[model samples]
Target chain A: MIVDTPLLIITDLVKEFNDGEISTTVLNGLSLSLDRGEFVALLGPSGSGKSTLLSILGTLMRPTSGRFEMLGFNLIGARDVDLTEFRNQHIGFVFQAHNLLPDFTALENVMFPAATRKGRETPVDRRRATELLDKVGLADRRDFPASKLSGGQKQRVAVARALMNSPDLVLADEPTGNLDRESARRVMDLLIDLNGTDGTTFLISTHDETIAGQCRREIRLLDGRLARERH
Target chain B: MTYSFKVALRYLASNRAQTALLIAGVAVGVYIFVFMSALIGGLAVLLLNRTVGNIAHVTIQAPDRDPVSLYGRDSGTLVAILKSVQQRTTLQSAAAFLPAIEAIPNVTSVAGVVAGNGFLTKGEAIAPVIVTGVEPDQVSAIANVAGNLVAGSGDLTIGIALIGSGLAKTMGLQVGQRVSIRSERNIDATLLIGGVFSLGVSSVDDGAIYVHLRTARVLFELPDGVSRLEVKLDDLRLAPEVARRIANTTGLKSIPWTEKNEQLLNGLVAQARSGDVIKGFALVTIVIGVASALLLSTYRRQSEIGIMRAMGATRRFVVGVFMIQGGLIGLAGGLLGAGLGYLSLLPFPLPEATSSTGLPIAIGEGAYGTAILLTFIGAIFAAIWPASAASRVDPVKVIGP
Candidate 1:
């Protein structure tokens, strides 16, 4: 189902940090592109700018210098509000910490992105959230508060939430970083199954080589730039 | 409910203890505001009632005559003529002005009074007194002489007079005892004591006397005129405007009770201003409480806010969630505090003139609407800073890096 169309393109992306008198470059002229429905793994060691690149790609942070376009929209210089609307409709995120609202139930957590975009929760959002929870194999735990859920269950709920809006692409940063081996395997299996069944593109950052091997394509970063790519 | 409000509610519900404490703080502030308002309002009403209860709201007296020039217009020489010192100016044809005075809206009663300085002599114990003479039936028209009578009745017949308890005690006079009242005109008459009153005012209780209008006219040699006219109104607050109208209707000098009690009015205004300052401080406390608590909430929910932002929720949405939390807290606290304030003041008894402990707090005057509105609006204003701070949460920092 993988299309040859370019879902996102990043060119000469540069990011730096300034601390008073010292300057440090995090991303130096990084460039890459992802095809539609591609399950890509971003591999890097610490301080390699994988998170920064993902942040820039997620429209959460602006790179110091770069040309970034996704789905034919120029994202590098867009207004924050307009970028937020674009991101809500077309991009989703799954964080390493599984940052679910601890006060909300699993079902509510899954429905949050769509509900927030629409200003209120509709029955269709509820149905889709329920179906996503079932797809993630936690439909029975949908009513449980996220804080009460185990680490693995929380990560599964995060995955359901990321896919709630049917976004074209999902940027997952260390999605299995905190999970146990079995939990991480199950989460990766769910992501791969969803990619095959729904044709949703995924760009996942991971430190584990085993996790990187599961992706259809693997890209490695060194000194903030793409060092190598294997398809 | 909207997603923002739902998120706010979930946040509050998750930390029940903290939310309850925050609401309690706001409630206590609102309670203080409501209690202070009711107490101050009641004190003002009590003071007004005590001061003007038995006094004329508007008094009509004869206008003073201006001295005339002795020179004729053709002579072109002015000579000042002094006013007559012996003659006491009286309101001539005072009965003719009663109808016009009574016609004023809200005027309750009017009494023609022959007021003059007199002496009460019982044996060799003689005391100077201010005499107020009114018709027998209208004896208590201007003052609550009948209601405050300590002994005998307020019957001011031809041979009967009323005196204050202090005067009676001073002269060793009792009801039905005969006493001689002599006017400044050197006219004297013997009358029996009809009533004794204690109005709780030192001057009136010590040196005031009430007699029949016919008796006073005969004694003061004013058979065709009264000294002044006393007019009472349903509401004492309307004295100034009513006084002006009465003055204009009848060519007489009219004075309102407010003009005579300027110092008391000033004191009341000062008291009210102090109360307002206290109420304003209560509102400030509410604002501070809501702001600080919401700021803490924003900090505690940083990662969650970051996640929502990364999920493509707008900064405005994040701000909306926090602001809604503040508004809900304020509304709940306001309602609870208003109810508690009213219930707290309910057991206290209404003020009475004779009651030793006059706790003048009118529960009905708690200004509930004002307190609630101020708290709600203040809390919303308080949320602004914390909400903005929440909206500035960097998703990249909290979510991963």
Candidate 2:
């Protein structure tokens, strides 16, 4: 069916990676969809294609076979320049490892992308970065380098960094997987709050059932295909 | 570009060791270039002043005449053409071009005297000398020969010769010694050594002997004929132009300072050229050092570079950041080396009183501009590969588990 209301539509996505002398296929003809302002989660066992689908959907990787559309732009055959512009304008990514730039302070890291987008960092960028750091509960630690931040705090800063350009879609890959239960719960609550207040759409890949249970929709992957999806 | 530089600064600040290494690499090149040039410049000044400085600005001789090899052949009579160009009263073959030259705006003082080759003898001690026969007044006007005389200058007369210090030692002849003058000329006779003088040049002081023009003419059988005319101009540097004028006007063989001793002049040029070669080698080394340091640092940041690309930085931005870092290192090192070189030359002392051995190490204003350009090139050449490699990275592999 032609889905008119869908924000992201993926049809038959496949991925392969070579492990030493052996080639391994990670995904096989997978299909998925996400609507506007929808907070969704993909859960799977090890070696399943949940992370593969998330990466392909986020435009960080190319699928072997598939056509995906985000906000009316075709990513399947788009040039690198177009893809970069799209990624910069629309997608905010938070990886599982909380990969913050170790050299910059929490606030500077958050403001880095904003300055890049605007061509120069004005006073507004600084204010917004400061406001976002406050939102991540790092107002006091905003000046601290990324290396100094705790695991939970680093993840929070990554979240602030992702949202710097106010991207419409935030793709988070196992963001709270490295956190303790209390920290994971707090991070999950922050995601839920951002979605509720800003109406920002989100897609998270996780193994944590507690975090997944809180999402409005859950998609399960098995053997590189979508086994079931429920709302 | 500002963003790229800011990123580069941050990276350099984070890696102090790498930055320091890169700076040192560039500094070595700048130092080599400056000092090498200084050596060449110093040597050139010394040789030119010592050999050709005290001589006439332009010397006209016969067609087969050579200035440095003054004694190898019988001198030519260039006076026939010179006479048609200008008239003089008496029958002496040469005249003073001094008054005429002094009238010309660009011309300075000029004088004509006699020079010949002879052997001097004192008991068993004998020496060969180029005998410059100057009148007492002419000696004072042509060059500072009287003032440069070492022991006694006023008593210099018919048979007495003001000898170089080195020759004085070798001949074992002291002042007031009765010396025999031998020449293939008319008035060759034994005479007294009235005085000795040093002009600091080994050639002028040691290899030369001087007497009155009248005595030399008598000794050489050239009663009323002069050997050559010496001309001077307002600026010593304009010798070539004045020489060209002399050659054109008099239609005779005229030699300038730069041309008189060609091989010896080439020696100084070769020295200056070596300085440039040293600088070139230094810059090349800087390129190698800078390249290695920047490459290592870039490779170390594989994961971070991936993260940056994943964060939506364009490939151009990725490469620019590293290149900017290289430029910073070069500029900083160049400035520091220049400052150091300038300060070092402050107490520059030379063993020679007039500095003929080497040019003291004062930093040339022009050199800094050259250094700044080279340093930037050195630094950027080092960083280019790393920046390109960083830009070539795949974000997928970078952020992969």
Interface RMSD of 1: 1.3
Q: What tens-digit string does per-residue lDDT give for candidate 2 at A1-231? A: 123588888898888887799977889888888888899988999888877777777777888888899887889998776777677779888889988889988987888777665556678888998999899799999899999999999999999988988988899999998999888888889899999888788889988887889999999998898988989
Q: For model 2, name the residue pairs that clash.
A: B42-B359, B150-B197, B164-B205, B187-B218
Question: Using alpha carbons, what is the TM-score of model 1?
Answer: 0.90
Q: Per-residue lDDT of B1-401 in model 1, one digit per residue for the tens?
A: 88899889988998999999999999999999999998898888777777776788898888877766577578777766866656677888887777777878999999988988989999899999988888988888888889999999886788888999998888888998999989888999998898999886767889888888888888888888888888989988889999999888997999999999999889989999999999999999999999999999999999989989988899999999999999999999999999899999888766443256767887767999999999999999999999999999998787753
> Could you tell me which 10 consecutive residues in candidate 1 chain A have the lowest summed lDDT?
A1-10
> In candidate 1, what are the lDDT values of residues A1-231, reduced to their tens digit?
656669999999999999999999999998889988999999989888898888888888898998999998999889999999888888888888889988889999999889999999999999999999999999999999999999999999999999999999999989999999899999999999999999999999999899899998999999887889999
Q: Highest DockQ: which candidate? A: 1
Misplaced by over 4 Å in model 2 are: A1-5, A18-21, B25-129, B133-148, B154-161, B166-194, B199-203, B210-254, B269-278, B351-372
Candidate 1's DockQ? 0.67
lDDT of each: 0.90, 0.75
Candidate 2 C-alpha lDDT tens digits along B1-401: 47777788899999788688668767767766656555455455555555666677777553442223223235763333222323222215455443444554455666666777788777777788788777766764555567776666545566677777777888876777777778745346776777777766787777677778888777766677566666666556688888887666655566776676778767866776777788788778877877888888888998888887777788888888888888888888888776665566556553223454545443342276677688888788888888899898887777852
